[model samples]
Target: MTTFTVNGRTHQPEGPSEMPLLWYLRDLAGLTGTKYGCGLGICGSCTVLVDGQAARACLLHVGELEGRAITTIEGLSADGMHPVQLAWRALNVAQCGYCQTGQIMQAAALLAATPKPTDAEIDAAMSGNLCRCGTYPRIRAAIKLAAEGGEA
Candidate 1:
């Protein structure tokens, strides 16, 4: 059993040590907010926060994360009203909504670290998160709006 903290709660996930954190989070820990777009780490759809830094869950192994704190989209806020979330909503960032959770989670972490990120920073930071709906422009606008202390 590999023990890890998730969404402010402790979880003893049952699986192979090499099991991807994304699978552990979804199948074992029951935290589905961190999605799985691609099994590989190329897509940022399974983005989560490990000690407040955005990481690719699909790339992290459960065994390597024992005792670490993992924060998923569900942990970003209990009410879905976090500043970044609000900004995303205000900017209408979602189209199909399939990738919005990961997008929001990534944005939350970015805002936490760079409260006032520049356009280049936003582009660089969010470049890996692929939105099939092509919501990149709206996502960028939302990040800017959130940094400015209001919804987009």
Candidate 2:
């Protein structure tokens, strides 16, 4: 059994070792917040936190994740008030809402590593996450808002 921690809970994946972490998370763990956009690791829609850093769940295999700490969007905050999430709500960042969870996860990781990220830094960090609804401006604004302690 490949045991790993997800959302602060231990999980033993029962599928093949090569199964993507996205499947392990959604199919098995029932955490659907992390999406499957392109499945090619280019869209960043399946982003999640692995050991407090943003990782592409579509490309990471379960076998490669043993012992790592995985955090999905659902695990970001029990009260649904993580600063990034709050900022997302405050700035009205979601359009279709399909990609918001991954966007939030990536933003959370960025804010965690760089609490006050500059505009260029925010752009660089959020470059990979694609939003088909074209919410880039709002997303950047929300990131700055979250950094500035703007709560929902």
Candidate 3:
């Protein structure tokens, strides 16, 4: 039994220790906000917060997450008003919307660590999250907006 916390709730998922956190989150935990892109951990689509740090869910096994805290996009805020989320929405950053959740999560983690990141810092932090629709510019703008308290 692996005991961990997701979105403030504790879960002792029953399964193989090698079971990927991604599967448990989407399947057993019924939290589908985390997306699956590259199982090889190349894409940031499965990005989530593990103890307040950005991590790839697809690469993490539940067994290794014992006593860890996880936060998906859904758990980011109670009213969907997280600064990053608000900035994303205000900037209209999503195109297809498939990768937005992961992008948002990654951005949130970055903001948590760097409240006001430089443009280069934003680019470096967001390098892992690929936006197929080429919304990189808007994403950068949104991150900056969020860093400034998401007033937009």
The candidate scoring highest on TM-score is 3
After superposition, candidate 2 runs with Cα above 4 Å error? none
Q: Judging by TM-score, tell me the better candidate of 1 and 2.
A: 2
Task: Please give the lDDT score at residue 70 for candidate 2.
Answer: 97
Q: Give the TM-score comparing model 3 with the true structure, all chains together.
A: 0.98
**lDDT of the candidates, in the order given:** 0.88, 0.93, 0.93
Error of 3 at 55 (Å): 0.2
Scored by lDDT, model 3 comes in at 0.93
> Best to worst by lDDT, what's the order?
3, 2, 1
CA RMSD for every model? 1.1, 0.9, 0.7
Deviation from native of the Cα of residue 148 in model 2, angstroms: 0.8
Q: In model 1, which runs have C-alpha deviations exceeding 4 angstroms?
A: none
